[model samples]
Target: MDIGEGARPGLRERKKRETRIALSWAAIRLTVERGFDNVRVEDIAAEAGVSPRTFNNYFASKGEAVAARQLERARAIADELRARPASEPLWEAITNATMARFALGQDDHRGAEDERWAEGLRLMVGEPALQGEFMKTSAAVEAEFAAVIAERTGTDADTDLYPRLVASAVGSAMRVAIQHWLRAEAPGTMADLLRDAFAQLANGLPTP
Candidate 1:
């Protein structure tokens, strides 16, 4: 076989991915059943039928297992935004990319998954340790967004305040929209709520 062909992941990669997914699902279920604080890493490992060492190999902590999908989604959004047309406005690019990456459309699992994600958000918000990890992951995405903004706006990422500020504001708006959706029991489509939130951002807010 060719060297490049031999380097392909094949069956092993697929099995590893399945194992990670199993561990993530097990962690989420455990967290839901017995609060985040009460669930230990070893418990999640047992629930997933894996050893604690295997769990650590996949994730740094319990919070990582629970929130890894969200972080992956954010990175996807950032990558999409970075690939958008250079002429697109920063906000427009970010909003469109985020929706494309995260907005749940007409899928059957939309309702149930949204509820679970909302519950996870609530848990993270209330837990100091999880909240810190959540913020750290979010900040990484914000930095990626800032880099995209800086590139499109012809500004240096280190020196420009506008890009950084815009990135922070966009992340804040998204969090607010998510909280609002959870409060309303995730009514209607998540895509609709996200679009409405982006529209509000497009329309300048009045000074308090």
Candidate 2:
């Protein structure tokens, strides 16, 4: 369901999106509860209150379905970054836009949603089979951010190296922050870590 430029999505498109989200959530929940290999496509479809055929239409494999939730979120971040004020400095805009996606300055309460995300991350990190799907989603988001950077800087993402280079650098910073946060026993909030990481980049990574 591709809406035209500057056009809002219609009811049909909205319903399709809702169904896809529901299916992705259902897949994640079932896999986390029963292990990825134990859960079948039919089980996921049933959990989502959809048919196997419908599930097939939305995702080719259980791994793809499970990864779709994060992919959707990554795309939303790209959209947020694209919507930032054109006058804002590129680094500031990207940092603010990315941070806006999460609840900043809030306590790390382990809600059901948080558990789902944590479980999915664990699965991605621990399971060798799911790593490829996870990396694919990351690569897609990297390309998305590159395109947004290209647009903001008036460069061609396909032809210009600058936009892609900056985007990749930002992505690496974000990945490292996330990994550090995950490994820390009493780590600071992800928001703070992300802010610090981006600040380092924005300031040219001054010497210690």
Candidate 3:
């Protein structure tokens, strides 16, 4: 349900979001343990303690279920950005909104000492089934982000380039930061990588 900007979620909205998140986590965990190809939608539904019919009501496929958190986080970021004070710099608002939504837009819910989840995430990432859904989700997120940017900056998302470009760049930067953290086994906090990525972007990405 679409609440007014800055409005608190009612109980029903909260419960629905929780269910979506639960299903998403279930899909991700099962994929991590058994690989994407092996995990069926029924398995994810069972893991999430919901019926397959209920899972179908929320998502179309196992891949969509796994990527559900991405949509949630992106929507959260858009709302966060909308709530920022007008006095705040656009880049700073973007950074803070992104931070509020997810740590570097990665699943940073794991403990700092826990590395197994990262490994699992890396392994699950290569599944062909998940990639297409993930890509589509990312595009949807970028378009939503661009619309929010246009609203904030008084630009036309459909015709003007600035909103779309900035949204895409921010999305790309977050993706790169998350990918680097996963692929390189980077020891730094995902927050640090995200901050550096935004800093470079805000600084016009001056050459080293």
Candidate 4:
């Protein structure tokens, strides 16, 4: 099978992915329930029905485990952006790729109702280790975005300014949209917020 369509992961690789996801979510939920400092690696492993050693094999720290899901989500978005048709506009491709991830039923990021979830997220904002891991994830994914955008625009990511600027702008836009959505009293769906954000981006943020 080629590297794309039919390249299914083997059983071991699939199992590893499952284990990693389980550990990641377990870390997040446990941390949210107990706060970051209270949630230990042992707790996360037990929650995921895996051994602590297995957790260690997958992640060096609880912060890394907790940040893994967000990293994976961003990675998926980057991959989707890279796969868009060559004819599609860059901003359009980015909007579509992000929307694909935040589609209703797949994930609902609107604030309210789930106070515990919101509180945990707020706590994560204050967590140095978690924030550091997330920033690292963002930088890595932004690099991925820069490379893909460069390819699409026929620019060099290393030496050209356009790719990095666009990548940074889009990344910041998404961050702002998500944070606002999470913090608002009755924030609307992520789709609406994302559309507005990307619209501003595509339109050069003209005065409202």
Q: Quick one: best lDDT, which candidate?
A: 3
**lDDT tens readout by residue for model 4, 59-94:** 999999987887677777877888889999888999
lDDT of 1 by residue, 16-62 (tens): 87788778778777776678989999999999999999999999999
Which ranges of candidate 2 are over 4 A from the true structure? 1-9, 104-120
Ranking of candidates on lDDT, top first: 3, 4, 2, 1
Superposition error at 63 for model 4 (Å): 0.7
Error of 1 at 105 (Å): 8.7
lDDT tens readout by residue for model 2, 1-208 = 4556435557668888889988988887777667788889999999999999999999999898887876676677788889999999999998888787766313322322365556555564567777788788788777888998999999999999989888888778877877776656666678888899899999999997
lDDT (C-alpha, whole model) for all candidates: 0.74, 0.79, 0.84, 0.82
Where is model 4 more than 4 Å wrong at Cα? 1-9, 108-112
Give the number of the best model, judged by TM-score: 3
Ranking by TM-score: 3, 4, 2, 1
Where model 1 places Cα greater than 4 Å from the true spot, the runs are: 1-25, 46-50, 104-121, 185-187
Q: Candidate 3: misplaced stretches above 4 Å?
A: 1-10, 103-112
- Answer with 2 or 3, whichever has the higher TM-score: 3
- Evaluated at residue 80, the lDDT of candidate 1 is 87
Worst-scoring 10-residue span by lDDT in model 4: 104-113
